[model samples]
Target: MAERIFIDTQSANAMIDNGSAYVIDSTLLQNENSRIKHFENRIRGAKYFSIAEIRDTSAPLSLAWPTFQQFTEAMIKIRLPNDGKAVIVYDQTGFGTAARGWAMLKYFGYPNVFILDGGLPKWVAEGRPTETGEYELNFTDPVDWRQYLVTEHHEMRVLIDTVEQIVNQKNSGDNRFAIWDPRPPNMFQAGSIPTAVNLPASTFFNADKTIKSPEEVRELLQQHGLGGEVITSCMKGINASLGYALQKYSGNDHAHIYTGSFEEWKKLKG
Candidate 1:
């Protein structure tokens, strides 16, 4: 078993005070583009923290499109002291963003990474300290992390054509084809790709935002009819990443995450 890759806000605070960590926020959940202004002043003279925003764009799923190399490059170029460990803190209900970011780091071959558990919502609710204003990032040369790339795994992606191929196989009487929808049952769009089972990503976490045990995850997979090559997706791509992590960690390597998800589906069919 690999190390537990997620932490809580208190644990994250301790890490900042003692160990090394990085803060990443997914732009999708942010109410305003100016939300970055919240952390500007507190991090002004800070030496160890680095912040970044992952842009969510509507595109076809392909590992070639958003390579792990690009993500690692951005992290490196920002030069937040690589004290051999990094942890990403997200907002309360935005668990998907931190999980997705942590998964990307692992996919790129970076070992020591973690996500701040409970996210920002829990942090504020618990009366934890927070900084305000926009944080500036100093551009610096990123270390060569090519050796840590996990982009070679074809199983990590499922594109539009892949779904078409799967549907074709199903029409040809291939019962092995299966789809796993990681959104709430209601959120599962009216017309789905073909043969997908609904398995909300929320199933993978408790109210406290910790990863469930392997047995628990396996049960959820079975309950949702997630056998064979499961294509996981949510509204966009964040929650689907959590679905991917749960499946992969539960010993299902054949699971592929559909990055475009419902967002791309509606656009293409419209």
Candidate 2:
């Protein structure tokens, strides 16, 4: 396991310069227009990987985790580093998208993955130099990553059936679990899973896009009286992973992600 889940921009820059790390830009790309402009130039030599490419799009909820084989193929296509190199992932929005990448890599048993704290915005704000153009994937022969993958990590994910069971349990006055909704306050207000508490993921990040310290995160969750086994959800699962990551960093190893989230929940209700 990696000693830490995040790296400061200065540390990331030094790692890149020393060729000890491989940077991954996880920002969403649409028609070649990405939220992180000049991304290739901004982080010279950074590879690009779309979160969609590793998702189960055909499912009722598009953000659901990919099948094992699907995940393997995506990893190969991206030519992920396996030579004991540190893999650092970042996105335009602080840890939002990047945390999903971190979670995916961790679930697959990548031992040295980390999120670039504050992401691209913070890097650029620090006046770091960026390059332009797409960085090509360095294809390597495929290795069976399944051997290294954490198969039991799936146990931490909740599907529609389990979610329904949880709601029932809550209704029956069992509070063994707590659902943390990381969607915006308004979106959470519009509709959310029954018994889910709003704890917008944005609250876990500093204004500059860096994640709050573990102590701060612990304090915030404690202030809200949220504890025990926590299940994080959002409109989809992207932001939910951020909440889960925070919980894990704050010493809550039992934190889980409701991958189907409100998207599948609403469909089942309908």
Candidate 3:
């Protein structure tokens, strides 16, 4: 099994205490006011990052995947430590939109990245400390971002071209890869890539939105007939990122995300 990329609240707390971790508050879909309130009551030292900065702004949707240059430059804004400290990414829930940041960082070959298990809700439930203040970034010197440019595992995400190859392989009786759609049931029922399995982000989590154990997730994917490789997709791509992250948490290193999912597919291939 691939080592899990999830960190529990206790472990997260310890990392914070030891000053060996950087926490990214990747929570989106909220404004500065609401975000401020949440930040005022959030885990200490959590840095806020807009999902758009690391996206392909030219793409049809505001949430499109970032180009290599866009991603590297935008990621520099967060100023993640390259000194080997752990980096934890989380959204409103532990396993939601935050997966995009976690996934993108991993795709670029950052080794210490992790998704917080259970997220803020679980942290509060466990009675962890919360701090309030203006978020700050200490950009002592302009980083040589060239060192941090995503250098490997570009295959962590697949484009339309790659999806085409997978489709052809499937048509030729290849069963090693399974397409996964993480959209809601209603949207998924309306239309989806043929042979794609419906394994929405919700299916990989408990009622509380915290992800299930790796063992449970693996079994659930198996129940849905997913094999070794999983290609997760959705209307856009943010929601499906959580599914791809879940696959990694469950030890399927071969899992991938189709960043330009159904919408892009329809535009070019429909």
Candidate 4:
């Protein structure tokens, strides 16, 4: 069986203390301010071991590159004067930035990664626990992952392409890919990529945002040609990540997300 992923905070804390699992706070990047403030106030001086701080700034290349290689290497270089410990993440919410980071780590071949459920809000609402303050760390290595690693937006293979790619390919007679847009019909914007079908992300989730039943999910995928090469995107990448999650959960194992998404589209348009 696949490993069970947990989202509850108390359960996460117990697992961490007992050394059974690592935890990730997969809240959105835009929402971190309030969450971290709560963590600082309520947790009775809880000291976080390993936390990922993701900010909302474009890199020199306009990607989330800061957390990709330099951040990981820093973690590796720092030998805390203490024994080995579990890594934890504290994420604020906006567009699943932290959650996406956790997924990226898993994609990079890390053995274990998990996101904090309900993030800081859920933790406070349950009256469970909290911690505070900015963390202090010193970097020793200046290695950059881009030197050895490259993330090709076009090469990811799982993302559904824009209408532009579809039209171009159709004109060229390649005709091998299909597009699926997971946004709501109204928000789908004016000119969908040619050959693209609509499949709003909302239909795949319950009112609470959890996934729907397998039959329903399968139906959606089947309507959109699930078995074919799949790529997904939304306004930024949040809806796309949810779409990617549903695709993977629904047995479309090869689904990919166009991380820059329509946000990139508008930039290119201008």
Find the candidate with the highest TM-score and give its number: 2
Count of steric clashes across candidates, in order: 11, 5, 0, 16
Each candidate: what lDDT?
Answer: 0.60, 0.77, 0.77, 0.51
TM-score of each: 0.72, 0.88, 0.87, 0.61
What TM-score number comes out for model 3? 0.87
* RMSD of each candidate relative to the true structure: 4.7, 3.0, 2.7, 6.2
Candidate 2 stretches greater than 4 Å from native: 1-3, 29-32, 35-40, 137-152
Q: Model 4, stretches more than 4 Å misplaced? A: 1-14, 29-68, 74-98, 116-127, 137-167, 170-176, 183-187, 190-198, 213-216, 224-227, 266-270
Residue-wise C-alpha lDDT for candidate 2, range 1-270, written one tens digit per residue: 113778899999999999998888877643565534544355777777778667886786777788776777776777764557788999865665787888887776667888899988888888986778655554667567644344335766777788788889999999888888877899899888899989887887888878888888888987775656788888778778877777877777767888778888898875
C-alpha positional error of residue 52 in candidate 2 after TM-score superposition, expressed in Å: 1.9
Tens-digit per-residue lDDT, 148-202, candidate 3: 6566577788888888788888889997889999777998988776667886668
Residue-level lDDT for 92 in candidate 2? 68
What TM-score number comes out for model 1? 0.72
Give Cα distance to truth, residue 80, candidate 1, Å: 4.8
Model 2: residue 28 alpha-carbon error in angstroms: 2.8
lDDT of 1 at 186: 78
